[model samples]
Target: MPRRDRPRRAAFAHLGPLDTPIPISTGTAALTLETDGSVLLDVNGVPSSHLHPDPEHLVFEYMRWMLLVIDRHLAELPGPDASGAASSPPAPAPHLAHLGGGGCSLPRAIAARHPRSRQIVVEIDELLAHQVREWFDLPRSPQLRLRVEDALGALTSWREKRFDVLVRDVFSGAVTPPELTTAETAAHADRVLRDGGIYLANCAAPPGSGLMADEVATLSTVFPHVGVIAEPAHLSGKRRGNCILLASRRPLPEGIDRDLRSDAVSVRLARRPQVEALARAGRVLHSR
Candidate 1:
């Protein structure tokens, strides 16, 4: 991909003559300070990310579930014996690539949970990225680096197996950019992730709609295992909300489904077969 071929970012006109508005490709993004001192990234009025001063705390239910998915997978990795004994050193920190920077809440949380994990966030909105850094005090590079570039372009240029985890949370308005949800994009994600690595995304869809099912179908084309987690009510088509979609080259570890359902968030887990059924009413989306 060449700089000249990248999509042109037009200025947000609706936010005319605002006081230092944070200009982003997706409308106008602004930060709201919570009474508890947490920072919220609001993109075109949608609550995108929540950054808490205490990294241990996760303000969003979907994000917590996402962490649980990552934690369970990482925990399965073989480490030194539990007993006090001489053993090989621990494995190097996992490398993470975040497709969307937003408020960098997840990156910040990952930094806190896995202090050594190296993270790079691809955010198209440069002004919003700068604001997030200045306001959030996000962990600096070598720990977490924010790359101001298009997510797809960045992913396409990356070498195979460059990251242990890949997160796609980019959104334009309330919906994920259609290009990011296509099978081609899923392949690029697969290319960048190491074998046994995981891919997670935050997806929005109406209840009973084929959006989520179509997305799962698309990812299943590339990854052997796919799972969709969301509140039972949301899964039942009672309301619209964020659903966490996960895919991996290997089968997901055992007990993950149970844990996800039993967690505080109590999300419903839809496995590959179930996911296929869910999307049976929809068509697989392809790259434009």
Candidate 2:
């Protein structure tokens, strides 16, 4: 990991002269001011991260669901107290990774919640990263490191079993990069996670599009426990929105299937059988 721990340098690979128009996917970010004083991150008009002044206020529902998954597994530092029994000491901060760096709202939220957790975010757009740094209050290096590199490249470059939680949020324009949805990426992610670690993907696809199911199939190649969390409408394939996919070698948190679904959350948890049925018509992606 020393190779990636080095000093951060300028890495604007897509910028050019005024006459040259860069592709929107990797171009400079456009910060839009919302009416309510919040900020919107627009990358190629995809309506990326929405920044709330309060880190705890994640505007996007999918992002909140992602944090919920992380909190269930990685955020709990020490064992809970026992009635009339000894209490476990506080544990070290968790290690987390974010494959895509939008406005880095999630990292900021994690920094606020788990102050000591070490995090690394890989952003392919250096100019956008710099802009986000100047606009928002992202955690400084060592605590939350930002690397200007491709998501897959950065993940593979790191040493094996280095993170407690890995979150995949990268996308090209709107659709996820095909490479990021393949079994190869999942295999490397499995290697990057320590024992009992978990993986989450922010899947953006229309209901009945089959992208989510295919991605689930891809992940099934690596991890045994896999599930999907989304609104009832989306889970039923009657709506379109972001669906959070969870995968891990270890089983999902105890009673998680029943724990997270409530009127307050309004999200459904579809276990392997349901997920397989959803993806039964889809195929897993593999290296050429």
Candidate 3:
């Protein structure tokens, strides 16, 4: 069978209607969605789905951790100054573009953290986006704009616009749209990013797999610098890996270590042997 024509498998297991709240921790009640053979939790507006075949208990916890990490980074941005300042330290706030909406998790987080920032969220799954609004108490801030369309398609059509931050998180099973991960796509991303703009992506890779290596290689070709945050065992090929990649044409912010460690989630994982190893490995891989 031709690879391009292969049928895609269902990325989600269909859980029936969810009304009962599931406890994420001691007092937190996460929204639960039950499908025929799977269960999912809505934690901080991000859906953590797992199949019966793979009952990883920490999926929602991991998602929450990731959100916390992102929030921590955003929190570092200088807030509105005193003396009746007209604008924030970064000036005009950041214009952000989110390639995958995903329950508007990141967008909602950004809006709450950076009140002045403007965001545009692109999601191909209109139904999912709508479901997010129905389930979550997202802020009705004017900063957020939701668009229903293919992320790459929308990006291609909006070539005239530029953004300070571009986040790509679209995924389905083990496959991502080839167009979204190619050098050509990176160039498109570059065009949309303002000078010194940042690009962050959630890349999926299996242990001992060269998929992430290939992705890093591809991103390096388009950006001046690229860094990754991942568990250490994955970089060492000892366990399956899921990670976030950060790329930019300019240097990263000065206080990344301080900012990342400020959050409970990030602080817990910051000194892990695996996280440190991946950071070192990524530095080597991304070096010119």
TM-score of each: 0.85, 0.83, 0.67
lDDT of model 1 at position 79: 50
Candidate 3 — what's its lDDT?
0.59
Which residue pairs clash within candidate 1? none
For model 2, how does the per-residue alpha-carbon lDDT over 106-130 read when each residue is reduced to its tens digit? 9988887777789999999887777
Residue 23 displacement in candidate 3 (angstroms): 25
Cα error, residue 2 of model 2, in Å, equals 40
**Model 2 Cα RMSD, Å?**
8.3
Which candidate should be chosen as best, given lDDT against the real structure? Answer: 1
Off by over 4 Å in 2: 1-25, 75-90, 255-265
The lDDT values for all models are: 0.80, 0.78, 0.59
Model 3 CA deviation exceeding 4 Å by range: 1-16, 19-81, 85-90, 261-288
Candidate 3 lDDT tens digits, 1-288:
443564443333333256555333222224454454333544334443332212121233334344454454445545556566656443467678888765565576567556788888887766555555555544564588888889889887766437877888776534556668777777788889877777887777777656666677677777877766655565556776566666778765555555455434432333334433443354222212
lDDT of 1 by residue, 120-152 (tens): 999998877877776677789999999999998
The lowest-lDDT stretch of 10 consecutive residues in candidate 1 is: 10-19
Candidate of highest TM-score: 1
Q: How big is the positional error of residue 152 in model 3, measured in Å on the Cα after superposition?
A: 0.7
State in Å the error of residue 258, model 2.
5.5
